[model samples]
Target: MKIIQNFTDYHEKTPLALSIGMFDGVHLGHQSIIRKLNAISEKKNLESAVLTFWPHPRTIFNPNDDLKLLNTLDEKTYLLQKNGIRHLFLKEFDEAFRNLNGEEFVRQILVKKLNVKHLIVGYDHTFGKNKSGDFSLLRKMSDECGFKVEQVEAVDFHEKHISSTQIRNALAVGNVKEANEMLGYIYSVSGKVIDGKKIGRTIGYPTANISSDPLKLLPKKGAYIVEVFVKNRKYKGMLSIGTNPTVNGNSLSTEVYILDFNEDIYGEEISVNFRDFLHEEIKFENIEKLIERLDEDKKLTDNFIF
Candidate 1:
């Protein structure tokens, strides 16, 4: 997909069938809107595009609020591309850009710059300063600007609204199975393998430590049965998420010990998909006690495969 970082870089002459949103998790609701965009683009013979923002708007508007993200920029891009979006336009949500009125945003960015032929938006989508813009205003502006508008109804699952907040809450409480059900896939974390104290090796369960992205949200501290992917190969593993209380480490860490395998993987980028939560992290009395618990955890994790 062609990624336009700003409106200044949008030089395409062909009008685009566009959908605009934060699209944080790219969850099922976001997929519904993107699918509408794809269907419209195919019907109109126009390029499918998504206009999103960085700093998430909320982060800029409410700096004191804790903003945990479901996917990083690279992960969101990959998900958009997988959903048949051909163009991605990302705008930095800065103070200056935040002041644009609803109509001005439509005129300058959507209508003039992007030449959006059709806009697919969610039912509750709002924009402009103080979020004063709503679907009604967008439709009015689309009519005035001579463009088409498509409003997708909010998507629901199991009679409840499926949302990023709900998914995050599930993960925060260590409900990996519920989170995966809402996310349409296993909840995964990606990061670079980093150097760590080699204490796991001495205990017989060698581990690969990952320095997780600061922007990505982590699940509740616990041990989980997960599938580890490295260099295009998958391995069954048991992952611990905590501050390694057994070793008296004070810093929280995500460490994965690949079962039945051992090799140098430092500096390699890998992903761990959490399939099920095994148990909460506990502090062991000693190295021998920790080893015994690790052995039990491994046995419990062995019954599940991802």
Candidate 2:
């Protein structure tokens, strides 16, 4: 997918079938809208495009609040690419951009600038100043702007709508299975391997330390069954997300011990896909107790299915 960021000259002549949102996690609900865009693009021979915003509106509007996102900017792009969209337009959500009202946004950005021929949105889609834009507003504007509009109904799981916020809540509590159900895929964290205290190495289990984007939301401090990606190859692993209290450590860390794997990977990029919550981080009475728990975690990681 071609990624057009803010300040990038966007001069595509071909009309676009577009869906617009921040799409933080690109969860199931967002995927439904993209699927509609794909179908419409194929039918009308329009370019499948998504207009997403960065700096998250929340970060712009509520700078004081701590903001943790399900996917980093790059991770969101990678997931969206898997949907087969042709274009990914990233608009910067800044003070200047926030002032445009619904009508102005439609006229200046959508109708004139992007030449959006067909618009696809979610059931609860809203945009523009004060978020006054809705399905009703889009329907009204489509007629005036000489374009088509469609809204995909809420995609639900177990009677609850699948949403990025819901997925975040699940991850916040280390409910990765529930989060993955809503996301339609495994939740992952991509980071560069970094040198650490090497505490795990002294034990039988050696771990690779990960340095991730600070804004990236991590699962609750605990152990997890994970699939690790290294050098284009995959391995099963057990990940720990917490301070090593057993060793009197103070700082939190994301460390993973890959099964049957032992090669220096520090400074290399890797991704860990969370599968399930294995257990909570415990400050065991001694290092030996921690080792026992690590052995148990390895067994669980090895036998994990689906």
Candidate 3:
């Protein structure tokens, strides 16, 4: 997909069919809207495009919240390209851009900038200052603005609506299965292997310390069955996200022990895909007890599949 970073940088040859949102996780609901957008674009012979924000608006408005994101910019770009989106207008969400009100946003951005001929939006999507823009506003101005607006009903699983917030909540509590179901893909984290205390090596379960994105949302502090991708190869593993209390450590760590694998992969970038939650992190009485628990975790991990 052609990624347009600034609103002024978007120069389209044909009228565009577009949807605007932060599209944080680009969960199943977001995918549904994108699919509909592509269909409309194809039928109208217009370019399928997405207008998204960077550095997430929440991080700006809620500066002290330390907002965590599901997919980083690179990951979101890859996913959008995989979904066959033709264009991506990724604009910075700074104070000046955030001040654009409903009508101004429509005239200056949707109509003037992107030449959007059709708009597909999630049922509850809202934009502009104080989020005053909604489906009703779009429909009311469609005729004057010379564009069509579509509001897709929320995609639900088991009668519950799928949303980025829902997915994030699931991950926050180590509900990987629920999160993945809503995401329509495995929930994964990527990082470079870093040096650690090397405590696991002494217990026959050497682990690779992961230095993941600080802004990425981490699953609950626990042990989980996971697949680690290293050098483009996937290996089954048991992953731990915790502060090593047994060793009097306080720093949170993400470490994975790849089953039946042994190699020095320090400084290499890797991805860890969570498949299942195994157990919660605990404060073992001693190193021997922790090792014993890990052995059991390995057996349980071996039988896990998702």
Q: How many Å off is the CA of 178 in candidate 1?
A: 1.3
Q: Determine which window of 10 residues in candidate 1 has minimal summed lDDT.
A: 5-14
**Candidate 3 residue pairs in backbone clash:** none
- Candidate 3 lDDT for residue 42: 89
Q: Write the per-residue lDDT of candidate 2 for residues 212-272, one digit (tens) a residue.
A: 9999999999999999999999999999999988899899999999998989998999999
Candidate 2 is scored at a TM of: 0.97
Error of 3 at 122 (Å): 0.5
Candidate 1 local Cα displacement, residue 305, angstroms: 3.4
| lDDT values for all models | 0.88, 0.90, 0.91
Flag the better candidate by TM-score, 1 or 3: 3
Task: Write the residue-wise lDDT of candidate 3 on 189-217 in tens digits.
Answer: 99999999999898898999999999899
Candidates 2 and 3 compared: the better one by lDDT is 3
- What TM-score goes with each of the models? 0.96, 0.97, 0.98
Please report the candidate that would top lDDT against the real structure: 3
Q: What TM-score number comes out for model 3?
A: 0.98
